[model samples]
Target: MTNKKDENKLIAERRSKLDLMREGGNAYPNDFRRDSLSGQLHQTFDAYKDETLREEHIRVAVSGRMMVKRLMGKASFIKLQDQSGQIQVRVERDSLPEGIYQRFKKWDVGDIVAAQGELFRTQTGELTILADEIRLLTKSLRPLPEKWHGLSDQEMRYRQRYVDLIINESSRNVFQKRSQIVTYMRSFLEAADFLEVETPMLQTTPGGANARPFKSHHNALDMELYLRIAPELNLKRLIVGGFDRVYEINRNFRNEGVSTQHNPEFTMMEAYRTYAEYTDWMDMTETMLHGMVDALNGSTLVSYQGEEFDFGKKFMRMTVEEAIEAYNPEFDMARIRDREYLADYCVKIGVNVQDNYGAGKLQIEIFDATGEAELREPTFITQYPTEVSPLSRKNDDDPFTADRFEFFVAGREIANGFSELNDPEDQASRFRAQVENAKAGDDEAMSYDHDYIRALEYGMPPTAGIGIGIDRLVMLLTNSASIRDVLLFPHMRPESFD
Candidate 1:
């Protein structure tokens, strides 16, 4: 047959099936009264070991999508899966009306149905339902993926997530845990007196973090706007407007590369507190995360990717210089002040260094290459160089370093916090330096916001702020290896229509 003829024939067959269903009744029914769920059935039968037919005589009205069917001439066994679990249904021709039985036989594996039945034990001792009546809830035109092998292709599973959720049990569990983790986090924050607030996702100037922003044009204003890379500046603006404690759990967009750890768009949680420092933020992080671990796992210890991690234990603390020394004792901190020497050392270790960058940038390169992955447990590497941390306050003892800390776990950076730079003059100078870097072809450098500087000129309070990558935290708590595993619908390339 020709391609066009085959297509026309398939369309005609689907129309005929639809017409038959319409004649029987509405194809999709409105009401399905489910009395007991699959999980509830399991709970009710938990104590019944010796299952005689008498104890299993309680009738249940259950509704679910038909997953599997074993049909005989006079009787059939069907599996129904609800949200909680799965239960088997036994339908005999003598039990249901002849017309309904005929319709049940016509039902496919993916069809939704409601069944009124009594519980019973099979010869294999599995708990099942003996159906007295059955009704079709919705007809599924498309066949489900294979039952046993499932949608095994990673790309296909991501692209067609509904099919993946139907066949793959593990995928559903990951998403369920993701929801639970977010709920626990929100409760923990609320209990701690943090007021959750939302800020604009699209902004005129993206000043929060050091990354390229995804730009969009505003047709109404005939101007360009950017999707926020982070919500730090706006949340702090709230702090300046007299909100002492504030947080936002929302999406951030970065026009950058995608990797196992990186996504073009992802969720983040940022919080700011009045009259606090990076040290206080570290303690808060430990407490919040330890509480989550206990709530989720009933203990502070969690095993992720073959390593045992304990969140309740005292987290290791070290300065950036100290971490560098711990990892590479041969390196001298005094020589780190020399830009040429630092640049050569960074190049030797395969660190990217621009010609205009100074010793501070080179030091960050070395830390990323050697120091970050050395951290296996929860640890805070503090006191970053002032040049690289433009928005952080300079250390009182050493003006060259900033009062900043980054939390690392399992060789990845999880959170960044700092005592914010409240000095308007100092902040202006730092912003100027960043502007120079941007002009020199540093696309990832932050833009200097004059309005933010003006807000600081009004004498903003001493404050501390932190941004935690929510997806990464979920990955850690759920023992998921990839960011894509935690995200329900991760970004993907568009498929070709042809």
Candidate 2:
């Protein structure tokens, strides 16, 4: 909590400063305009130092927050940083009016200012601007973080992202890359004839993905609503409505634990295309990911957490059974129906297998615990057990497995796609099973949605759909290790209760 006295004291000081500025006839003038950016000026005139001509003089107006200041008796050197880049500003007492130099000396580092200056090269061969006049646009009351040390604390960086962006150059770059990656992804889908669509984020029944929902009350209707866990059900409805190719890049909310890989609210790009299956989605995933890597990294190869991963190379494809065999050769696949044997194996491997877990669920838990992290490169783990993949189409050869695949990179699941289950009866059965599981123990279970089943009954096309974790992809492209690094303002526990 803020102390009232301290708050009042700060407010009084700011008011006094404003009063003095207003009396000087330039409190908050809005007449200044910037003709060129700091970076554009540097790029255009950086090479004109040696062959100086009278006609080569360039006058540019630039505005930015002062980042650094070096003061001398009569002349001073400061660095002005705009959104494009930074340029050195050389201010001299002789250049400005008598009292203007003294006023400029009182300006702090974070104050926003506009300067009309001539471009030149400094003694150190650096591009600079020699300012003839400087106007203070806005004064920053709070002090910025130290220039050399930076905001090293993770919690503070996430909570106070503005400060983080100022002190940490890498943080700004990560967000820049994130924006570029999303823009490129949108272009890729649009070029492929996929129509971008919007879906409801709040639904009465949170269906589509197996996850716990954050619930809220609708005061007018006196009813309950859920923040959507996934936009799968509604997006598929578009398929039934004859929009064959559609995609949505949006946020999904889940009431879940937070980890380096997970956030309560995260972005996902979900798309559906008619007449395609999981195999078609696999090819699309590889091509799009390779393109993104090329755009950001200039190569398909990227390094993450000490491992070099190649996105361009053919991703390794394997079934769940194949992964199981490779990891545990001694496990008897024929005897997988034997619950006791599976339970014992789970205990040995330190998997949290509940007593209610059947053969398929236990296998998923074991695989996630042991095999997931071992997949360091891009690989598609396909043919997931049907019990855990309720909304996916069952394989023709084996009813126990689904025609699904999850793309893994850097030991993390980045994308999930499958041949969607379009059969209304089958989907209803699966939803029943998921509801039973939710009642029994699992909180992250799909809810029974009758409307979604009705939509399925109207005949959805045989479609292939995918949901790619956008934040995680941004992290990979930006070489960011934590979820917080890419997110500008990730959620955090309140530091003080008011």
Candidate 3:
């Protein structure tokens, strides 16, 4: 580890060079244009022989941060890193304009530089750029963290993400893959005729999910507002207004605890299709996921956290009760639907029992505690309790449960979908029940949005909606263990410089 004194000394030395550059009148220059990426150069030239490259005399301009610098008397080697990747640049004293080589020798490893050179192959068979011109673009004030040990401190990595991304290729790749994942999802949905729409991030009343919202006061209007926890309600309103198929990919905020799996602010893709049932959404989800896996990874199998999941196979599906029974064999299946039995079971399993809790809620609690984690494969746990799913339609044969399914992989919830509850009366009653729960001290309960109820009165067609957690999905696809790894700038505690 570099001690505070050593780090400060390095910084002072770099600052001295910056002071000299400032005296010369151009400490920062912005007019350098690059004609090639490091990766693209390697791709185009790696296959050719040294004689072929000399004959072709391919000239290109490249700019990136100097990652590696080997000062070897007359000739030196420095690797420049761009967005694509890094390429080796060979700088010779004889090849550069009179005093520039001296200045390049003083340049730090983290300095951004632009170089124009001819492509050539080194004696060792590696592609190289023999530069005739090199210009310092940006003077990096503080030296980057040691490249060998790299950025290993998790807190510091999240706090100083810019440094982390520069030093860690895996971190950069994860975010790149995250972008590709979102792009793939958007393209897939667009191909299916889903219209992308934006909804307000600030809401008058937060609904659509049972999560506490981050509150904000509108000073001009003298009214309270909230950062939306989910866009489910507004997206549904669009459905009622005649947009049969709608989707939104945006940020949602919640006043919640952070965990390996949870973030207070996160991204989600919520899509709704009118005249579609939960089952239809489930099938669409399967097709999309299967195709996504095949497209991104070139295979239907994914290895995550040492476990292999086969998207090639149909995702396992079972009712929530069945999942509970499958994971907890000792539970009496005959009394699974009994209210008193479920309450007792919940208490036996150390679940916090509430006065407003019903048999359906108890079953959900038990399942969450015992069954959720055991679902290591891609599985859809369906038939959620109506007590917990206020917006979902009640099952035709069983009014106690809703037509909902939560998709899980590696035991973490990834997506949730349900048949919409279009009946205004039923939805209103459920909203009242939620309000009562809030009054009874459930801070995560939903507030009744009367406007949504009014929208339902206008008669929305049978619709199905789903919200896919983009961060978690990225984690799964990119093999990132923490949600922080997938987020470029996840929320962190303020650092005390003192």
Candidate 4:
């Protein structure tokens, strides 16, 4: 690591260079235009021999940041990296205008430059650009981190992401793959005839998910608003308004703790389809994810970290109680639904049992503590408890459980889906129950949204809804271990420069 003193010295040296450029009247030039990218040039001309390239005289212009410099007395080899990739430029003093090569020699690494030249192959058979002209485009004020060592501090990497992206190719590739994953998701949903829409980011009432919301006050209205925790309720309102299939890829805000699996501000894809049951969503999720794995990995298997999840085969579906029993057989299955028994078991197993927790909530708490992480394969844990899933429809035969499933892989939840509770009376009753839970000091309980209840009163068709965490999915696909690794600019504590 470079000490602060040494880093400041380097920045001062670069600043002096900038001062000289400023004296010459053009410290920053922006009119340089390039006709070719490094990757594209290599792709089109790599097959040609040195003699063939020189004979063909394929002229091109490229612009990128200078990454590597090898200066010999009168000639030099410098590598310029563009968005696509890197290319080598050969700068010869004899071939350029008088004094130009001397000026070029002073230009530092990390400086953005534009070069126009004909392509050739080096003696070592590497492709090169025999430049006729080169111009400095932007002067980088601070020197980049050393190339070989790169950015080693994880916290520093996240804090200074711009430098991380410039120095670390792997980091760049992760974000690139993130883009591909989101693009593939959008295309996949669009192909299914789902209409993409936008909902309010700032809401008067935060409905949808059970999470503490980040509050904001609307000064004009003199009313308090909230950054939406999820777009579920608004999307459902569109469903009630007769949109058969709708989806929103949105950012949700929650006043929550951060972890490798959680970000307070995160991206999610929420979709609702009318006349579709939760079971239909299960099928669609399987198909969509299976195809996605094949599209991204060219195989049905995703190797995340050390574990491999198979998407080709049918995703395993297990009930919450069954999973708990499978992972913790010491607990009595017969007493799984008994609130007192489950609460006692929870306390025994180190879960902080709350007094107001119902039987369904107790069962879920037990499952979360024991079973959630053990699900290594692509598995759908179904039949969530009604006490924990206020937005889900109650099962027909079992009133205590809701028609919901949380998709998990490699021990983390990536998606959640459930049948919509279309009955206005049932939804209203559930809202009242949630309000009561809030009154009992459950900070993560949902608020009773009368407008959403009114929307349901107008009669919505049987709908299925799902929210897929785009960040977590990207982490799985890109093999990134932390949620911050996938985010471009993750929230961080303010650092003191002094």
**Local accuracy by lDDT, each model:** 0.87, 0.86, 0.93, 0.92
Error of 1 at 160 (Å): 0.7
Estimate the Cα RMSD of every predicted model relative to the unseen true structure. 2.8, 2.2, 1.6, 1.6
List, residue by residue over 1-498, the lDDT tens digit for candidate 2.
344533565556655766788888877788888898888877787778723712577778889989999999999988888877888888998988778888898887887888887777777887777889988998766667788888898877898799888878888888888899899999999999999999999899887788889999999999999999999999999999999999999999999999887899999999999999999999999999889888878988888777788888999998877777677878888866567887889998888777678888887877887788887778999999998898899999998899999998888899999999999999999999988988889888888889889989999989999999999988877778889888888878876633
User: What residue runs in model 4 are displaced by over 4 Å at the alpha carbon?
Assistant: 1-7
Candidate 3 — worst ten consecutive residues by lDDT sum? 1-10
- Provide the TM-score for each candidate, comma-separated: 0.93, 0.95, 0.98, 0.98
Encode model 4's per-residue lDDT on 332-410: one tens digit a residue: 9998888889989999999998889999999888888889898888899999999999999999999889999999998
User: Order of candidates by lDDT, top first?
Assistant: 3, 4, 1, 2
TM-score preference between candidates 2 and 3, better one: 3
Candidate 1: tens digits of C-alpha lDDT, residues 326-391: 887778778866889888888788888898888778788888889999899999999899989999
Clash counts for all predictions: 0, 0, 0, 0
Superposition error at 25 for model 1 (Å): 2.5
- Pick the lDDT winner: 3
**Distance from true position, residue 267, model 4, in Å?**
0.6
Candidate 1 regions exceeding 4 Å error are 1-19, 49-57
Q: Judge candidate 1 at residue 51 and give its lDDT.
A: 58
